[model samples]
Target chain A: MNDLPHGLLTPQILVELDVLERNIERVARTVSAKGLALRPHAKTHKMHEIAGRQLEAGAVGLTVATIGEALTFALHGVGDLFVAYPLWISDAQAKRIRELLSYVKLSLGTDSIAAVQQLARQLADKKDKLGLMIEIDSGHHRSGVLPDEALDVARAAREAGLNVIGIFTFPGHSYAPGKPQEVTDQEQHALGEAARLLRADGFELKRISGGSTPTAELADNSLLTEVRPGVYVFGDAQQFELGRCQWENIALSVASTVISRHEGDAQNPRRIVLDAGSKILGSDRPGWATGFGRILENPDARISAISEHHATVLWPEGQPLPAYGEQLRVIPNHVCVAVNLVDQVSVVRDGEVIEHWDVAARGLNF
Target chain B: MNDLPHGLLTPQILVELDVLERNIERVARTVSAKGLALRPHAKTHKMHEIAGRQLEAGAVGLTVATIGEALTFALHGVGDLFVAYPLWISDAQAKRIRELLSYVKLSLGTDSIAAVQQLARQLADKKDKLGLMIEIDSGHHRSGVLPDEALDVARAAREAGLNVIGIFTFPGHSYAPGKPQEVTDQEQHALGEAARLLRADGFELKRISGGSTPTAELADNSLLTEVRPGVYVFGDAQQFELGRCQWENIALSVASTVISRHEGDAQNPRRIVLDAGSKILGSDRPGWATGFGRILENPDARISAISEHHATVLWPEGQPLPAYGEQLRVIPNHVCVAVNLVDQVSVVRDGEVIEHWDVAARGLNF
Candidate 1:
């Protein structure tokens, strides 16, 4: 049992420093071995301390989901940052982007001609300071243009006096069961096709970024120059259930005390309520997820349901039910969303809290 | 179209003041007419401004889900407060609860003997000032004990020298389709049975509380002394889909700009990506929810998928897709979770940003 800090609040986020350091080292080592620049997505941990550690472990830059996040890291003295989402910049964002460029080497992703035009109109004076990456649709179909259409976006970006640096795609579909390798193949093909088209059109594709947590290790180094994988640093239940990572790799968990418990009859099963719920753990259960989340100590137990402040964990039958007030560690379904839900996390080593890291960029999704 | 403020950030929460006031007024008026006290659940909005408005409209107190939340409101001068969840108080919480009781008329819910004993042990000196409400299991089996078991808990509270105030239950099952009325009936019966048992056992049942957003209006005035409904002030997509409220009733929405849009092929449907994803809109789709959430203007449209920073809105087939960079209001699946995700909300009046309210109690689920 982890000895939580005395008077530690329930539903508090606990980052296991040893496990976190190992996870970061392993990913950094693997990416270095493959000769791919690692831009660990700061959106997962959203902590300056973690970002500093990633940079120390040889990360090229930090990948973020929003310009607000980029600015946060830039202000915190992180020199290189990439806002990896297709941002539809407002006048405020355009100004912020300009301000960010003055301090850090910043790049942004663009998927449409309209966005490129808007960016040019908003930041016309600072066009040379901005670097754009044309987003390719690979197979996720969430954002990004089709691989064939990447050239049009690149041409528009160049014509509008914006620097088109490269192409990128997020194989988000890799999150599904047994689909990482297949998604990585699609990612490589998409990047390869986009790069070829852009290159044929006299565009020097300096960067070809692709990868989510599931496909990060399987990234084709020959085709992709960089990879942006967020959730690997703090492996979540979704990653664990998808067989992408093991329980030992999960570096972050919610320290929640059991508040209520019930032994069911014929129709129902034994259950316990944890102080941790969607408010802290977040409510991001993918369709393929086993349950709401996983109880770290009891792999067989499932977090059956969650409300704002109550996670109803279905205790595995015959396993001793944890006594009321006993604290347990719960791995959330999606670490990125979970991390965004908190303001700070307890950095613990050997079951003792050593420091607290502010989730400085949390809720900065502008 | 609502004329938003210039340079307004995407995925920013915008709470319509007119609609919010109306929603609050309507609920307070209804509960007043029904001769029941209204304790608006502050967990939904977590704003002192909104809580102040609710109190001005005639709320007996504010209902909170955690001691942290209660403390937030109590410190903000919300004189009467109740932490309505079955809290397993720690030493820190007990100390905080005692501090809370020193200023506010604070009450807490208990369902188990262990929790009651823990409370007694921790707050022995403050027993006279502390109020305990035994939570009765209505139809929602999430928390609370069986209605018949209320007497035992009340006895335990009395034995512990704690002030037993009443009994309460959350008819959470009302959130489903065709379940509100039935669940309200169950709530009445449960409260009535529990009150009867406690009164027969010489326990004074001064405050019988029950009601969620779906069953708030239908609450039996003779049975429930007070109704605690959190979501009525900001009707969500879930409430609308469940036929609990109309589109006009929704007061809170995420102001998100369209970042990317694509015309679908044979395999997929056309979609637009909104900057408001789970991080801002929240990922709380109940089993019966129509989609992730509903768009205010485009009611037919569905938020088909969401990542941490992108809400993939599947636009209606014939509806003209929103232009790139156009801002739209995206109602979250659950308003409470969405409110908790942000630090502040832009309070809009007559389509103009008037003020910003801090989400003071947000993420205060300790």
Candidate 2:
């Protein structure tokens, strides 16, 4: 970054080394203290360096949201991976999974018996087996089956020669402020009911994987054998707003250059525009979000509006507005989406570039 | 696409070749009929195939939003290109532009005198000069100077040894429903006033580029010399909702496989989950957007919710919900964003995959 000119790449993703290491070690130590298997979701950083660092820091495995992402990490030598998405195993995906089985320890998530049946049909001839985890719907209501239906899916997986390990749930509702405890309770309740039902059905379930970024710190390890949190590796504005982390905990931000400024009205005399638009910071503002994103340097200045390639920040009156050619760090509302939008992120330490990690699984959405 | 299994590697981007060609030809013909130059914005599809075809259809050039995008197209033999963005060129970027100028006819958008001065300092030593377009603030206040400021920016560009070509504006406010005419008029008024001002400054502007997808068809020809519409070749739900294009005019969509289903409540019984999520279709819903996206086969079925890897479509009651493993076509809220989220798009004609176009400039935000 120092070698390049001042405003070359106007908006680029950057990771502070100290913040990143601290964030990773904090979660690793917490999960260790709780005696829970730490499986940092590879879906967040999507970089092999981060995954390698996570595993080196005592992460048992790396969890991912898709087989494609899992394959990317597996190819990069992440030996154990759990695809925590309810996948409908198509023939090609089944073939890919079978190929992956030869390289690493693989686990799949299933929410329906139909997907399990299809998996059974496709992988019946494969000699290797992949672990299956039935996704239990806690409070997100986006996916997953009820606890009662977990056994049925597990039964189908067992019948299809797949190993039913345990169950998992995403307490996604925890993303909102003041919902962490309620969402964690919901996660434990759902997983507990599923585990009990599975045990009653005579299934010896092992690895119970669950937890989102918001619920990772609050989830009880007694209920979940393993925890998967993606965004904790790169704290975002949402996490800060939800009180999951402090301002210093935000490890990732879009380094944008101020390109223009204009006074729309007399009262709004401090509107500074930056090149970090929705294309760089991403457009993932929840209804309760203050604005599109917040400036790390000027926390009070909010990105009042955004176009595809422009962030209009209505700077607060007290703080001096950024002039042309000035660089500012923008904390996006959702770091995961912002990370996925970029090809690489520059890892910095003490204001110096250390490494540029490629977002390897950036567009691997299949 | 037909050669693949029922549910493999979806939710994949699928483009109907016939529809894509027709849409392209329709816009090209419309622009030609008005004796206007067609420089389709490559930021939408980011495919060399589409840009090549647009040029083949009598397009004067291709318009892009970044220098990185310009380099990608220039390398692919796009001889003429325009970066329709207010760029704060770093030394590295200025060098990149210098390199790009060696390959093609390059013009850039600039709204500020500082950027003009920087361009002059960077390109002063170079023998070859690049065209400059002074961006006028239309209805969108994202970037661009007001009409009155265009001459100052143009004067700075001329002084800096840059050839001032024309004025341009992005009437982005036309995106909302019932705002096309107002936005188009805004575009004309802004560009007309800027052109008049620049002409009065003794500069005969040549290429007045303007128009976005919503205001493309409604724009007055005499007011602007060229039209740069990104999403016209692949209409999205936003265009459809704004009456800019009909449902049939939508040439691109995500081919998603139904992975799960559930009866949520007594009233909302039909819910089919598809593999297409925000990762594939992109998360770009505005406040007024209808659901996340609409299903093509079942238009009434709105994707009520979306997760990172799952789209839950709340199928309207009285219609039989799609079974598991069924394929559904989803029209995303914005085509440009959705296109950027994928690696490649499968081109289809007669229910068969004809070719695959790489999103070559997918993440070229720099």
- For model 2, residues B1-366, the per-residue Cα lDDT tens digits are 223324437888889888889899999998899878899999999999999888999899999988889999999999999999888878778889889988999888888999888878877876246788888888677788888888788887777778888889988878887888888888888898988888988998898888898888877678788999999998898888778888888888888888888877752335888988887777888777888888888778888778777898887877777877878788998888888887889898777777899999988887
- List runs of model 2 lying over 4 Å from the truth: A1-8, A126-128, A158-161, A266-270, B1-7, B126-128, B266-269
CA displacement after TM-score superposition, residue B357 of candidate 1 (Å): 0.9
Q: Write the per-residue lDDT of candidate 1 for residues A1-366, one digit (tens) a residue.
A: 356556677989999998899999999999999999999999898899999999999999999988888888999899988888888878788777888888999889999999999999998888888889989998888999988888889999989999999988988888899998888888888889989889999998888998899999988589899999889999999999889998889999999988888887674457899989899989988888889999988889998889888889988878888998998899999999898898999999877899999999988877
Q: What is the lDDT of residue A228 in candidate 2?
A: 93
- lDDT string for model 2 (A1-366, tens) is 222224436688889878889999999999899889999988888999899889999999899988789889989899999988888777778878888888898888889989888888888876246788899988677778988889898888777777888888888778887899888888889899999999998898897878888888887678789999989888999888888888988889888888887766652345888888877777777878899888888778888788777889988876666777888888999888889888889888878777888999997887
TM-score of each: 0.98, 0.96
Per-model fnat list: 0.85, 0.58
- Window of ten residues with lowest summed lDDT in model 2 chain A: A1-10
- Model 2's interface RMSD: 2.2
TM-score of chain A of each: 0.97, 0.95
Best by DockQ: 1
